[model samples]
Structure formats: C-alpha cells, structure tokens
Target chain A: MKQKTLALLTLGIIFGGIFLTMIVGAWTTENTKTPARYTTGSAEGEYNPEDIRGSYTLGEVSTLFDIPTEVLIKAFNLPLDTNPDTFKTKDLESLYSIVAEDIEVGNESVQVFVALYNDLPMVLTDTYLPTQAVELLLSLDRSWSQETIDYLNAHSVIVTISEDSESDKDSALATNESKEPDAESTETNNTTNNSTSTTTSTAQEATTAPKTEPKTEVTTETTTEHKEPLIKGTTTFQQLLDAGIEKAQI
Target chain B: MSKLFKNQPKTLQKKLSIRHYVQFFFFALIGLIAINHTLVETGAGIPFLSDASLHALCPFGGVVTLYNLATLGTFIQKIHMSSSILMILIFILAILVGPVFCSFVCPLGSFQEFLGKIGKTLFKKRYNHFIPQKVHDVLKYLRYVVLILVVYVTAKSGYLMFADIDPYNALFSFWSDEVSVKALIVLGITAILSLFVERPWCKYACPYGALLGLSNKVRIFKIKRVEATCVSCNKCTTVCPMNIDVANKTTVTDLQCISCMACTSEESCPVPETVTLTLEPLNIKKPVSANLNQ
Candidate 1:
C-alpha cells in the first residue's frame, strides 16, 4: 500500500477505535445526571449547607482563614455528610476556638484544619489532616499576646511574636490587671440596672478588647523601639508563641 | 509502453486531484441532508443527530470534550450540559492552532475544501482572485462574534442553537433519516458558497476557523519556507485551497495558512527541501524565488 494510504488507514483505525469508544461511552453511559448525591468519601466531599449545625452554617472559610473546602475534603478524604452538623457541639466549638488561636499564632494549616474541622459535623468518620494545613500552622504570625503565648507554650508549640518596645511589660501587666477595677465598678453599676444588656456588652467588649490591646502594644513598641509600625493585627511575640504551645495539645 | 504513457501527463490528468472534489461532494451531500432533516420530520430524509449523539460516532468530539473538561472546569451533567469552559477553550485553541479542526478534522471543512477545488477548475479565470485580504480578514472575525452570540444565547436560554445549525450534525443525521432545518440552512449556505469560492465558509464564516486564524501565529507546529531552495514557483500559492501565498514568506501568513500541508506535499510543490513544516526558527537570509525550474 502507498504510504499515504497506509497513513490514512492507520488514522481511520485509530479514529474508529476512538469513535467506538465515544459511542460506547455516550450510549452506554447514562446521560450524566446531576448526581442526586455526590460520591461520599471520595477525594473531596461535596458542600451541603444542611450538614452544618444549628444556625451556624459554614460560610466562606476561605475568607476567614484562606482554606478551601474542596482542598480539605480531598486532603482528609472525609465522608460526604461530614458537615458542621455532623460534628459534636464541643468538637465544633473546640475547632472554632482552635482556629481562633491558630489565627492569633498565624498558623495557616492549623487555621485551615480548624476551619475544616469546625465545618464538619460530629457524626461522620474518616477524617484526615492535610500536610499543607500542618505546614501552614507551624509558620504563624509571631506577634501574639502573653496570654496567647503562655497558652501556646503550655501546649508545647513554638511561635515568634512581634514585641512592643514602648510597652513597659511590668507596667502594662500591672495596668491590665489593675485597670479592670474601674471598668468592673462601672460594669457592676450597669449590671444592677440591666443585667442582660451588661452581660452581652461585657462579653463582646472582652472578646474584642484583648485582641486590640495586644495589637496596640505591638504597634507602639515597634514604632518606639523597633522603628516600624509592627505589622498591624499581630499578637505580641509572647502571645503567638503561647498560642502555638496551646495548639500542640490538640 | 503503457507505463510510459501513464507517466505522460494527459490534459485531464493535469487537472487537480478529483479525490478532494469527491470528498467535497460528500460534505455537500451531508449538508443538504442535514438542512432537509431540519425542515422535515421524516426520519428517512436525513438523520438528525445531536452533539451528544454524534459524540458516539466521532471520538474526536469526545477528545475535544475531555480537553474542555480539563481546561474549563466542567462537570458532566445530563440535563444541563454547559461546557462553557470547553467552548472558551475551543475558541482559544482555534486562535492558536489556525482552525485545525476545520482544515484537517472537520468533515465539513474537508468537504468545503473539496468543493473549492472544483470551483477553481470550473471558474478558472473568474474565480482567480478570491475575497480581498482586508475583507477576508474582517470577515474572519465574524465567527468569534457568532460564537459569542451562540454561547450567550445558549447559556441564557438553555438551548443548543449551534447544534441545531451545525452542518456536520445535519450531515451525520442524514444516515439516520433525521434532519434539522437550521442545520440544513447552514449546510446549504456553506455548499452554495463553496461553489462560488474555494472553502468560502472556512475563510469567512466558520467561527471556529476564525478563532484558529487568530491563534495561528503562535502555533507550536508551523510551516516554514526555505527561500534559498525555492525556485520562485507560485504553484504552492495557486494550489493552496485557502488562497495563501506560500512562496513568499518565512512563516506561513497568519490569516491564510491552515497547516493542511497540501502545498508542501511532493506532488503539489516539487521543490527540493524548499517548503517544510518545522518546530524550529526560520532563517531570514534566503529569499523565496517565484519560478519553479519545471
């Protein structure tokens, strides 16, 4: 046969095989329906809002900690229904707390893991941790507070914290412990008038104040002593190291 | 004596290969059937085939689908087959590959090219000058606009307009006795145009080809001319179904070349190592000659 004829024949055979395969694939293959349910326990679990617990559905974890659910599901090989509702309240809350702590320490993977863990419900099994998540947690933002630092250290995790030079540690500690007296007195008076309002306000203030105070201290210290505006939102170095220590426990 | 006689070129034998024209006829036949099927409901007229259905007979479509899946993040679904990503990728690939789907793969393109050869033979003098370069270039862009419009309408309305209008589908359906009127219209227009000009639809109307032409400049595999060896023969240029001037340039002109390799074939351009397809850089020193020694 001529080379052209042979080449054409070869092409025809190859195309014929491919055509047959395609026909088989399309004909035998049921028109791909939107899976009534995604494959459970596949590399990645599907996202279903129904899996989340209570009113707290998994919003954008990526925004909070830059963790994609798709990555977590694939990495962990989590079950399909392993959503936020499936996890015990304690597990979910603990996961949330851990993520918060990881944020303080700047541990990326731990933060992602916690986010993913929190999103999963308590019931489903086959959980796995991603190496990327672990790597990310180990390299956290180092400027955490002393409380966070102490917590991390006790947990046996190490972290670097940015320090505040202007902060007279001794005075700041004294002020933190002492300044509460005036605020507590005012709070007490308000509590007597409207206990519910006072409690809610106090809780909100307590959560927010701690985060901001440490940031302010770091900024002040960086400007006065380090000659820089210590990267904002970073916990004091002591706090971050402590946060890492706390994570080591889990 | 018979061998010697056979070796001598007779007047009819000197004509371009009839195989391409035959292939072109088959393409037109298919197109006609497709259009007829679209117009009528008789299963015996022309088979009507959907992209999904034809996907069974043509593995190339499946390969194309897989390519769409990888690049476009498409999930295969039955009811809503939105391979927008695939469509986009096809467009992008067309820009880079010079509408290869049309030139080499598309049965429709093959048919059109075949008809174009016939048009060349019948209207030798009148059809000598094809569409003007600038007008051709502008018209080439129409496919993108059509693609965009078709895709937008399909996405928004959830209808497969292209599938209905595609001549290839119309032709494939002819065997099954199912034809699509829209598809038939498209095929009819394409066939009529082919009679007037060589591969007219490919040059001006094929949206897919338009995209390929845009990307032809960056294709990894391209044709290069060895100017020094060229006997300045314009035979390559004349024989080009797409009306490209293959003799002059180092690189195949972006708008004209389809990588069919017809011009480079031994029978077409008998230059010794003059025109070649290569992945390597072109040498600029050698100037292409216009006349062939033959």
Candidate 2:
C-alpha cells in the first residue's frame, strides 16, 4: 500500500478493532486485578494464591479465601480499630518498612497465609509472615508436613506488634475472658502487650497507621433535586411544603 | 535573521504529508486519552470519550503480558484485553507493510520527530548524524537487549517492571500520580537528546521498536531500489531517519526501517519510481563471469 493508504488503513483497523470490542462488551478499561484460577490439581478452578494482588483489601481476601477478617487482622497484628473492608494488603509494606528491607511481610505474606489457612497448594516464595501467623498455622489440625512447619519456623519474622496503651489493656482483658475457639485471636493481641514492652514502645514510634484514603462520595442529590420542580418566581410556601420541605425547616 | 537568509537560495516550503497528519492525530488522541483518564478518576470528564489508561491502550503491554497470560491465565496488573487486541491489529499492519505504527502512529516517535525539526534547523546538514555509523550499528542492537530484559522481568515478577522507567509512559502521564520519578528522568533525557538525535529512544532503547523492527525481514511490501534509473546523488540515504544506505541496497530489509517511506521515490528520490515500495522484487544482476560464460 502507498503511504496514504497505509496510514488510513492503520487508523481504520485500530479504530475498527476498538469499536468492535466495545460493541462486543469486551472493552475493559478499569483496573480489575482479578486473581487467576488454578488450572490443575485438587485446586483446579479455584483461585490461585499467586494471583493475589497488593490492591486487594482484607475483606475481599476474607471472602475469597473463606478466612475470617479478625483472624487476618490479629495474625498480621494490625491496629484493633482498622477497617478490614478498606485496609489494602499493600499497607503492610509501609507498616513494616523498617523490617521489610530485610524480609518482605506484605501481600506475598497474605498469599502464603491464605494458602496455608485453606490447605491449598502454592508455589513457595521467600515471603515471610508475622510470628503470630506462623503460630496460628501450626495450631491448626491440618495435614502439616514437618518440612512445611520447618519452613514456616525459618520464615517467621518476629515483629513487635505496635499499639497504644489503651488498646493493649483492652486486648489483655479480651484475652482473659476469651473462650477456646477464640483463644488464638486474643493471644495474638495479648502477646503484643505482654512481651517486648520496651521494643513495643520503640516500634510504636516507628509505625504509622495504615493510610486508607476516604472513598469518593458519589452525590446523587444534584440529579434528584434537578428532577424536582423548583420553588421559584412566585411559587407559594404551601408548594414548598408539598415538595417535601417541613414548614419549621423552611 | 536577515544575514542568515540573505545569501541562501529560497527552498520549496514543505507541506504536511499524509504521515504528518496521521502522527498528529495519534499524538493528540493519546494526550487526550491520558488527560481524560485522570479527569475521569476525579469524576469530572467527558462521559462519551474513552478514559482508558495508557497501560490499557498500549500494545507493548500485551507483548509483555504474553508469558503471564499463557502460564498464569491472566494479564499483568493494569493491562487489559484492549492492549492484546491493539497488539494483534498492529501486528497485522506490520506483516503487511512493516512497522508503519512507528512512523505513522506512535506518539513518542512523533514527539521525537517534532523535536528533531528544531535540531535540523540548528545543526543543518549535521542533523541525525551525531553518532558515527560504525558505533551506531553496534548501538542499535541494544534495543533488542532491552526488549529481552523487559519481557523476562515482567514474566518473572508478574508486574510491568519497565513501566517505572518507560519514557513513553512518562511523556503522556507526567502529570498523573502513576508516573514514576525514574520514568520522568528517562523522558527528560529523551527530550534533551531529541534536540541532538533523531529518535534516540527508537535507535537504542525502545523495546517495542525492537519487536516491531523484526517485521522488516518478513513484510509483504518492501522498499526496492531500481539499478537502472537510479541517480548516484544518494538523496534517499541523506533523507533516511534511521541512517540506512537506501540507495546502495536493492531491497531495504534493514531491521531499523520503520517503513516511514521517507526514502521512497514519492518522498526523497530525485527520479520517479526509481526507489519505490512495491510487492515486486528487484532483478538480481548476473555476475560478469557468468554473463561471459553464457
């Protein structure tokens, strides 16, 4: 083809492909990091742990892996008040940046935790989890090969859980009253206050709260108000009241 | 300014070619898409226009995600189905004419060429000849290395590793939060270098360009030089952006050829239909000994 025809043809093909994709409802532009499913083994058709992204929230992880949000929070030693629905797994990178330079305790750790919790097969990496996560995994009555336990022992990072004094007191109280099934949850929190009090104080100074940006509040009020008749240009007070405005408020 | 032009002969004013118009269209479209993407993120953009991210629009993303898609059954993060579709379409075009995307479509190539105009005026005859031909021949192969490293790393890490340092991404997404400092640095260096060189990135560093350049060897339509009507003036070689010796070659199968058609008879050749892009192959000349024996 000549340069002119080539140029036109190139534009036509590209635009045509895009238009066709849009018409076929396959033109995805959003950042949707959907985890890939396993293709083989007992976990066939199940979500692969390796496909877990840093963008996933703890709540999403909980739903996907069938793990409790509380267990995740406690295992990771996240602040007691943290909203699991908003807390991204990437926050662990910043939260443990001091130690992460040596051993990364971030999204990969979450993947490992989820895999072990569900007893699903996984490709092992150099990813490390908190000591509490290791302990929680060991306590489970699952089919734990000695090699896996040894691997967990070697990979466990002993990060001092950093929280304020009031949360520590509440954690201690919860631990005292906790039942058998809820024992690990309280113990994970209680360990933060009981041991390494000096290190905990230092770690508290180093650690910052995980930043969860406020979700954009979509306002429907403008559209709703636009649909309503405007009380203007000789409109009556009775008309305003009929429009759903209280007389006293008006 | 008067002294500069006083003794100089008046040259013919160059008009915009079909290629120039195509370049401007893509450059403007990509710029608008990037801005629209950011505006849409803030919930205040034109609703009808596409607000796809640069990653979503880039065919290179599709190239990088191939291994991950095959092995893991998923694309790299931030890349989507559109990238793969665009890749397929671009490859089809490449197979037909060879990397017309680089000359007629790439916004980055156009951006560099835009800077190269200023370089042409400043350096005059010396423009696009900053590097020695011998050194350039060796340096041009670096882009292949870059392509290999990018593909390998992206596959291993399951991330777009090149994104952090990609000058093309930085050029369009400089104002956005997604642009990395390393990418900005690379973009800045590329901009400054564009004032001295013609498409320095495409010559020595563009992984995508390296991938597309391979199409030159297998393209259907080829740039062929006629041995009979060819003037020895070498205008085709002088006008070549990639510094290819087009006048000497019977068939231009140079890997660096973007199929820009700059060296074609329609563009730079003094004789009509002498140096042309055609599906027909040039006649191979018989050797002197073979002709004598015959």
Give the per-residue lDDT digits (tens) of candidate 1, residues B203-257: 7666556555666667654667778788887878876777677877777856656
- Kindly report, for each predicted structure in the order presented, the TM-score of its chain A compared with the true chain A: 0.19, 0.57
lDDT of 2 at A88: 72
- DockQ per model, Cα: 0.02, 0.28
lDDT (Cα, tens digit) per residue for candidate 2, span B1-294: 765444332221367789999999999999999999878645579777788889989999999999988998798877888898899989988888898999999999999999887777667778889899999999999999999999999999888889999998999999975688999999889888988889999989999999999999988888999989997789999889998999799989999999999998888788999888888454678679977989
Highest lDDT: which candidate?
2
Give the range of the ten consecutive residues with the poorest summed lDDT in model 2 chain A.
Answer: A197-206
TM-score of decoy 2: 0.70
> What C-alpha lDDT values do all the predictions have?
0.43, 0.75
In model 2, chain B matches the true chain B with a TM-score of 0.92
Candidate 2 lDDT for residue B93: 85
Name the regions of candidate 2 deviating beyond 4 angstroms. A31-33, A40-45, A54-59, A69-109, A119-250, B1-13, B281-294
* Interface Cα RMSD, each model: 14.3, 4.5
